[model samples]
Each structure stands twice: as C-alpha cells, then as structure tokens.
Target: MSELTVRSMTEIEFGQWYSSLVRAYADEQVAAGNWSAENALQMARQSNETLLPDGFATAGMLFLKGELHDGTAIGVLWIGLTHPRGIADCAFLYDIEVESAHRGAGYGRKLLAAGEDVVRRHGVSALELNVFGDNDRARRLYQSSGYRVITQQMRKTLTDER
Candidate 1:
C-alpha cells in the first residue's frame, strides 16, 4: 500500500478527470441496459453539461484527485454533501475511479480511505455511495471498507410476446 494523498482538483486536472467520469458513466449505463452505447454517450454528454466549468463548486460538493507518494495521479473522487433519510449531513460519494493501469495495486482502497478522511474533516460522520449491480469489484471494495447495503433495487425486463 502506497502513501495516498487526496487534493483539491486544479482547473487543469478537472478536464482529464471530467472526461474519465463521462466515459465511466456511459459505460455503466450501457452495462445496466439503460441505454445503447450511442445513446449512453449522448446522454452522458448532456448530463454533464451543467456540471463542468464550475458545478462542483456548488454548495456542498467536492472534487478531488488521488496521488501516490511520488505525486503520480492515481485516481479521482467526487463527493457531495447530502442528507439521507433525515440524517442531517452526510457525504455522498458520487464517483471514484482508479486509473486503469493502476488497478489491483491497492490504490483504490487507499484512495477510498483517504477520501473518508477528507469527508470526516468536514464534520460528516456518514458516507454513502451507489454502486451499479454489475460492478462486483466495487461492491467488494465497499463491503470490505465497512459499508453495508441499506437498500437494494431490482429490475425486470418483460417481454412483449409473453
């Protein structure tokens, strides 16, 4: 496990991070069968239209980059302040990604732990995140990190010929 550092994203870093986020979102959407590849790309572009340039500056949102001990960028984490179930204030992890090449090196786990420390400094006691059903790796990571399933959402595809 390398020493992890989480820092506020600079403007120059935002462009690369945003691109990765959009790509991830589209891929997840496609995996979930919510949209075709083409449609997912279009929808992802549209969905992020307002989020760039300055959206993360909104009330209680944070965009951070994770770096290794040598200052190599390893990942990004986006968190938003939210109150779930009237719990007052909690941190919601909107997105987290470890660069493809850095996967399986324990970077993701370190990045998440660093993220929790960042959120905790903001006085948030709880952290919540949503992971797609098909994302087994992420599910396992979150579970190992002490996150529990508070709810489960299931979907069914009905056939017209039936």
Candidate 2:
C-alpha cells in the first residue's frame, strides 16, 4: 500500500532474477504453443543470451527491479535502449511482470509508469513490446494503458483437424 519505485538491478539480484526469468520465459513459450516443453528451456536461454550478450552489463539494455516503499518486490522491467531496426531513440520493452501475489493491486500500471519514466529520462521517444496472443490479461492491460497494436499475427492449429 505504498508507492512503487523502480531502480537498477544489482548483480546479486540479477543472478536470481535471470534464473527465474529464464524458467518463466520457457514456460510461457510452451504455454503459448510457440515451443515444445522439452526444448523450451534451452531455447529460452539461447534467446536471452543472444539479446544480453554481456549479461547484466549489456551496453544498451536496462534491467530494472520494481519494489514498494516498504521494499516488497513487485516485479521487474527489462528494456533495450537501442532497437535493431534502425529506429532512433526507440526503446523496446523486452519484459515486464507483476508478481502473481501482487497482481490485482494496480502494481502493474505503477510499474509500467515507472519504467516509462526511466525511458523518458533517457530521451527515448517510443517504446514497444510484444505480448502473446493467448495472454488476454496482459493484452487488456496494455490496451487500457494506451498502448495500441502496431502489428498483429494470427495462426490456426491443424493438429486437431488432421
């Protein structure tokens, strides 16, 4: 019931956060039907390594932790300052999450606002993120937060039909 604050993650925190992020990302991939459970962990690790080649010191990446004034961790926000498509000053939101235990407390929006403030301080003009189609809750949150869809993808599973 206090103000949420975002700050740079420490090395020790990064170690634990990275481990949990890898597992959670793998699980999310499997749940979204994007990767087989058997290979999801490996793939997730590879993907993360590719994006964060220097680990916590990656030059253009920012790994932030969100917590309340009382120091209860709400979640994390990971962002990339330099986008690949040659978009100047456009930041990419790699990940953001509100811990399950704190989900309905409006911490998500607070965390997002905090993250945006960080990006704004960096003089970044735009921020973008991708959400899995099946994550209706996340989609709704993003939409309600004034984030409009820039692109969309759709698929039809044929395994059941054939």
Candidate 3:
C-alpha cells in the first residue's frame, strides 16, 4: 500500500469536494426513497444550503483531502467538532469518500486512520460517523476500524389501503 496523506483542503480543491459531496448525498437520498432521481440534484442543493450555509467555512467544520505520496488525490473528508449534551467534545465525520477508481486499494481505511490522527491532534478523544444501512462496504470498513454502532434507525414502506 502506498503512503496516504491527509491535508487541509485548498481553495482550488473546494469545488471538486463540494460537487462530489452533493452528488453522493443526492444518490443516498434517492436510494433511501427520500427523493426522486429527477429532483435529487435540486433537493441536494437546497439541503446543503440549509445544512452548510457557510459552505466549507462553517465554524467547527474541517474539510480535508487525501492523497497518495505520489500526489494522486484519493479521497475527501468533512469533519465537524461537536459537543453533544452529555458527552465530551468529539469529532463527527460528516462525509468521507474515496474516489471510485481508488476503491479497494485500502485508501479508505488509510484515509479514515489519517482522519483520526487529525482529530486527535486537536484534543478530541472520540470520533463518530453515520453510515447508511445499505452501504455494506463502508460499514465493514468502519467496523474493522473499531467503530461500533451506538444507535440505528430502520424504515419500511407499506402498501396504501383505501
């Protein structure tokens, strides 16, 4: 495996990161039946606007890019510092994505480990992330990395009856 490095994203990389994030979110929304493909893009835009009004500049947010030692971009991560009502301050991973071409090369694991290091350096002792139930690959990665489920949500569709 090649060396993986995570660095704060530069302005030049923001556009790519934002675009990818939006597309990923939209895809998830469609898969979850929250939005139709025809409107997913628009809904994604509006949701992002509401959630990240300041974009990557939002307070407590950290945007990072992952690359190989040879300078090949492999992934992007978005983390946010959070203080839940009963727990110490911790880091929440909002998004983590390894490019499709780079998948299965261990880049995802490396990138996540690097993210842990980055958050730990900031004095945070815990990290949290949410993975959709259908993303088995990602769920496996997170599980192997020592993340256990703290909570889960399930949904089902029922036939309409008049």
Point out where model 3 deviates above 4 Å.
83-87, 160-162
lDDT of 1 by residue, 39-156 (tens): 8987998877654435555667788999987998899998876653445767788889998989999999999999999999999899998899988999999999999998899999
> Comparing 1 and 3 by lDDT, which wins?
3
**Total backbone clashes of candidate 2, pairs 3 or more residues apart or in separate chains:** 0
TM-score, every prediction: 0.88, 0.94, 0.90
Worst 10 residues of 3 by lDDT: 81-90
Q: Give the alpha carbon lDDT tens digit for every residue of 69-114 in model 2.
A: 8889999999998775667888999899888999988889899989
- Superposed Cα deviation of residue 119, candidate 1 (Å): 0.6
Which pairs of residues have clashing backbones in candidate 1?
Answer: none
After best superposition, candidate 3 residue 33: deviation in angstroms? 1.1
Per-residue lDDT over 1-162 for candidate 3, one digit per residue giving the tens place of the 0 to 100 score: 889999999877977789978898999999988899999999999987776778867777789999988899899898877643335767889889898999998999999999999999988899998898999999999999999999999997888965
Best by TM-score: 2
What's the ranking of the predictions by lDDT, best on top? Answer: 2, 3, 1
Q: Please report the TM-score between candidate 1 and the true structure.
A: 0.88
Better candidate by lDDT, 2 or 3: 2
